[model samples]
Target chain A: MMTAIDQSEHHAALENARREFRDQLIDADLLVPSGIAGLYGRGAVFEDIIDGIDRVVQRAGSAAHGSGIRRLRFPPVFPRDSFEKTDYIASFPNLTGAISTFEGDNKKHRALLGDRDAGLGWDHHLTPAGTMLVSAACHPSYSGLTGTLAQDGTTMDIYGYCFRHEPAIDPARMQAFRMHEFVRVGTPEQAQQHRDSWVPRGLQVLEDLGLSAAPVAANDPFFGRVGKMLAANQLEESLKTELVVRLYDDLDEGTAVVSCNCHRDHFGVTFDIKTEDGEPAHSACVGFGMERIALAMLRTHGLDVARWPARVVAVLEG
Target chain B: MMTAIDQSEHHAALENARREFRDQLIDADLLVPSGIAGLYGRGAVFEDIIDGIDRVVQRAGSAAHGSGIRRLRFPPVFPRDSFEKTDYIASFPNLTGAISTFEGDNKKHRALLGDRDAGLGWDHHLTPAGTMLVSAACHPSYSGLTGTLAQDGTTMDIYGYCFRHEPAIDPARMQAFRMHEFVRVGTPEQAQQHRDSWVPRGLQVLEDLGLSAAPVAANDPFFGRVGKMLAANQLEESLKTELVVRLYDDLDEGTAVVSCNCHRDHFGVTFDIKTEDGEPAHSACVGFGMERIALAMLRTHGLDVARWPARVVAVLEG
Candidate 1:
């Protein structure tokens, strides 16, 4: 298990290592070539990497639109009133960012200071979708699904970038990460069945990829006054557990590559998700910590990526 | 081009198709397993897919950390003040939300309102990460990277789930999507070289993964008054060209799966991303639209993931 002490040391060491590596790459001319569309040296290689990602996404058996999983993508921003209805601010005040309008003196100073090369001033930053974040990939899926979905039982798998405001530097715990989440909605039996099904399979995926993994109980990093209770309940019921393993980084504590959680109707009820039979659906999600997995593979293999096993190369090539 | 009219129609059809596919899977028993942890069903098969992803990540590259890329997971929340500095609210007012302090109407009502459910005259629903959705993955990445990164130029391929408030719903143009962004920071030469190098490599990867892709010019979805000028400048300078191809949902408009952007020094100047060399480092990114590519793969092969080509499977299985 990773403790605060372990995380702190890991963060410092990782930051140092990353800075060094970046310096080396720059010195060696191993970077994006000019003329590549977006910023750095973009070339067919980047496209190839993307294509490789596509193939993996397909093989994951969670094909989009089909693959027996319901897929719904909703607006990233939600109504401010929507969140207020849920009491999010009170529970996690420090972690939240609210978007507010500036119609006073502050707003005027911003206008006058325009194009000072300071970019858009603060006063102009008024938008209704303030503080809202798709903390997890499944939130939007639940919200969108509830909007017009039939009251019948449904299961959905939504994948997207889940963001957080952590100030850490551990590669395993990124501020921004790719989350491949499979969300389900239905009766308790249905939700539990969904979570139960993916556990062993998720393990197998790790094994097949030539990686070692273990399923362990996990908890969200819920901070502040409510965190203790949240943690206690999670441990008590074993509601949250993640698969942990060692990756390439030199961190003392291993990383969590996969988190298979059973939200247990937490979201279904919140979003008014109901089955065709009008029963409030219970929901569960199996989230793949994509970067964690990637780093794990790197550690399992050699540092020289070119020397990676042919089999692994073949998978991306295919 | 993904036009307004065509995009609307295409999205509607895609949604319908998505629903139909989900229904079919349930009827087939192949999908009844639901979650990844479910019993031996499609979820179990996802294990196999994960193996493929592991292989690819290992073969593609290696960082010093270990096998997986060293990830710096940060808190998923940002301060409200930070967003305001980014000018997000004014540019997209309708898409923003705000967290607020609610002063009750009266002593009795205020006291009652303290209990969210009681105040609302109903049970309070579950609230996930509120309005702090990431319009772009780079926003958070930049926030995290700029603060602690060594003055020396550094580069990283950060992956995350990016959300957008798209009123439209084309399968290719999702509201929530995964962006595999390879960002680099360094001198102009280093940045340009990095971008340039990926172009051919990107093409190769796509071909190796068995997808048809081509480079084409693009423009951002800038809306409103200044949006036109921004879009026009981007188009004229070819600032937003992407490598795109036709997806199965619609064979007419070419869908963008990979976008290679050259941010030049925009973010560098804005965030004051100074390189170890003491000069403002230029930056660029190669972004992969993971879902679009997956959708393309489904259309290219067949809806039935099992029937994918042997070669394609081989690469993924690697």
Candidate 2:
């Protein structure tokens, strides 16, 4: 049996891996530490690389014809009620970020200002702002499709900044990050086909950008003891797959830069989404973590974009 | 004298204006409210408009020669210490959003999860995550430039999503919005010239986009009675100018879509930034509020982008 000690050891190994990658990024001047554990300031070159990768990923998505894909953009912070309906709080309570503000009267505000001026913590005065930072790009997309779906189904391309509370030294895992997701709501077979087709396409997109990547079965980072069992069940059912790339030449393992997941009626049931035939619509999404892909490119091809391969340059520029 | 009664009346009028704009946006399906005041999900058409405006603004920025402008992008959140150094807490304490998480042990975690599952507020367990959501795009840019500047000066183009706590039904006043800012650091005169030149260029950019924009003196939305005096002083000094456009056919007043600001020596003093000549480096910036510009375009030239003037379409497309 995997004991608590085993979990501790596993966590320590992950921390070391994160530190190694962080050191290399810092050396390259690609990342400037924000004095926060999981947050960092990316320089101009890094920003350019991210922009190039995003463009290519967007182009790759354009090949999905006949699906009538609608593009949507959302703010990182979401309505608290909308978030609660997704059941993310019950599943991953620790990773959620709630928006709050100081809701005190004038006299209390004066004291709050004084505390800030005196370098005393002023967070105690913060009241809930009736919103929560988004944990996934597809949450709002799924919520938006609540009532019913057409017989032919619907597709959406969404991009947004997402937040999580898992603060770490890993350059790969950010507290706040960007996610580009293509979501489809349809029949079970249709949803499965949508994700499966994207698996090879996702890998090819990275390959075109000059990064070596592969798809492997994966599981969500569920929390605690019961979460361990849930994760095992997910892996057993093969519900998730990741497109991973080696972050460093010396590292034996690869980082998951893109994820393809089939939620299979879970969201439809939760959001009360039904097909025109009166059946629960199954959902699937292919998500590319933009920053991770950029990091992977930097790691595989080196930090200098000018020295990058010709094909990569052509794909990004063209 | 502006009494409490006057403040209440002013707020009521602002609320009415916000509702009018909100109703118009809803009718156009350009905005889907997130059930949170000042937050909305943007559709593809709205996204396209925003993208067009951003591209044109970037091209307009390219006209600055010899400035050697560097482009930078930052994540939405910044280090808490770096955020505190900006002294936003001392001024606008209520408008800041600090990132926090539920940092509790497994036993406490179970209780936290239970509370969330039971529909009890889970935010009480969230501890500070050591970072805060950004209030301005230029804050990180200025923080990154702390230390010394060359005698020739430094120029930077920054774009990022910024957050504020003000919540209303106003379609224009988003809690989370994108800001495109061009910043300069040099001697006072050089910084002043950078801002002054941008005023006409900003107006022209809007004019080319078929929106009649005029640069009018403006002030920041400072807080409280002391802030009112500060705003008056800023307006008197001509430190800020805004490109305004009419939001409604019924209203004569126009909204500020863009702002040109001269922050002479303020950031230098705050961040200890110095020039090669050992004098405090003055700073100035021209910021284009991306959503506001898109909204202005939608309001001024109907919702149909195809029907826009030939010159406007050419500039956006070309």
Number of the top lDDT candidate? 2
* Candidate 2: stretches off by over 4 Å: A1-29, A249-252, B1-21, B65-67, B249-252
Tens digit of per-residue lDDT, candidate 2, span B1-318: 769998788777767876977877866768877766898889888888888888899988887643477777788888887777777765676787877777666777888878876868878888887778888888887776777887688888889999998887778889989999999898999899989999999998898888888789999877667778878999999999999987754344678889999988988888889998888889999999999999888777777777877777777775
Minimum summed lDDT over a 10-residue window in model 1 chain B is located at B33-42
- CAPRI accuracy category, model 2: medium
Identify the runs in model 1 with alpha carbons over 4 angstroms from their true place.
A1-318, B1-132, B141-152, B248-252, B275-279
Clashes of 2: 0
Residue A315 of model 2: what lDDT? 86
Worst 10 residues of 2 chain B by lDDT: B246-255
Q: lDDT tens string, model 1, A63-108?
A: 3225566544333334444455334445444344343432224344
